[model samples]
Target: MSGSEPAPVEDRRDSWEGPVPIPSGANETFWEATLEGELLYQRCEECGTSQLYPRAVCTGCGTTDPPFETSEGVGTVYSYTVCHVPGEPGFSDRTPYAVAAVALEEGPRLLALLDCDPEAVEVGMPLEVTFWQVSEEAAIPVFVPR
Candidate 1:
């Protein structure tokens, strides 16, 4: 698929075992982009700050309805932790997974699953985005070392 198009969900059974992302309001476009293999963040037109967990108002300038922008899906690990305990249901089987706070190239920092051995990731490491489609309307962004 083209860069603008998301990779198709491989199978519906392999994503998160916890409560899935439900698209709502300002977050709806963000989730929709994931299905097409795109990552999105909201940018404040007034102050030029970009953010994630999409919001209706810009935190930077208090502007209502910031515009959505597509991310390049590239980032660097700012920090991370290995999860020995399941954070949610069905995650017990995924012990030793990594959860990372990544600083995207565009300036937004997002928390995402790291698709690599817990011992294999490091702060400042470069990463690229991949999606784990969990529901018809949402796909969780995961990262892999680049």
Candidate 2:
């Protein structure tokens, strides 16, 4: 799929036993966008640095409240790990999952769950974002093979 297309959405709310994100502060906007199947990153207009895990101050130039830009939702796997053990609560049943640091086409990288068979993942693998709705207000981004 092309970068401009909306990422696919999966309704996991009924089965989600994972930790749910509570949107607040700078994260409020990011989480809100996710509910609509958009992945957003902050871009500093002053220094042109893009960042994820939204913060009030820009990492590049100390600019306050950097403007957000929607990502193309396509990325490359920069790095990854396979979890044989549950690292977080409620993930015991989902052990042997993959987590990856995905480098988006828009410049920022996101650490997200790679929702695919662990044995199938590799560095430099092309991926696309998808959301798993865990709550009414938030959905976590998950990446899958493109």
Candidate 3:
């Protein structure tokens, strides 16, 4: 190879050096509940559907707005995969971790990392929510075997 240098490129995704945007109206109650180590989700009063990544409207029904409620944080593995490739920057240290879509008892499915033995995870495995404080205002929810 010639004695040349490549230009430096910046990763914009990792540029989030500041606090994360708490997604306007959805996560207010969820974060509030997190302060007390509780997990929260949106429950549609109109259709009785519980959903996550909280939203202003129910996915099942076209309700103008929905209500927030605390979740039991207990769930079962709806689906999962062992991530051999790190999907995010901070997760490099946690390579080969298991990520799963857990269906909470209340009816919402949340995607989070499974903090247990990868070999122990199964489609119907019971799990519980746990939080890791990523920032002063954000605590990411992870799951462990129940």
Candidate 3 lDDT, tens digit per residue, 114-135?
8788878999998877765544
| Candidates ranked, most accurate by lDDT first | 2, 1, 3
Worst 10 residues of 2 by lDDT: 1-10
lDDT per residue as tens, model 1, 3-51: 5655444444465576688899889999988887888898898999899
Error of 1 at 144 (Å): 1.0
**Tens-digit lDDT string for candidate 2 (54-143):** 999999889999999998899999999999999899899998999999999889998999989999999999999899999999999999
Which candidate do you rate higher for TM-score, 1 or 2? 2
lDDT of 1 at 8: 40
Give candidate 1 misplaced runs (Cα > 4 Å).
1-9, 14-16
Regions more than 4 Å wrong, model 3: 1-23
Angstrom error of the Cα, residue 53, model 3: value is: 1.5
- Candidate 1 backbone clash number: 2
> What's the number of clashes in each of the models?
2, 0, 0
- For TM-score, the strongest prediction is 2
Candidate 1: TM-score?
Answer: 0.92
RMSD of 2: 1.1
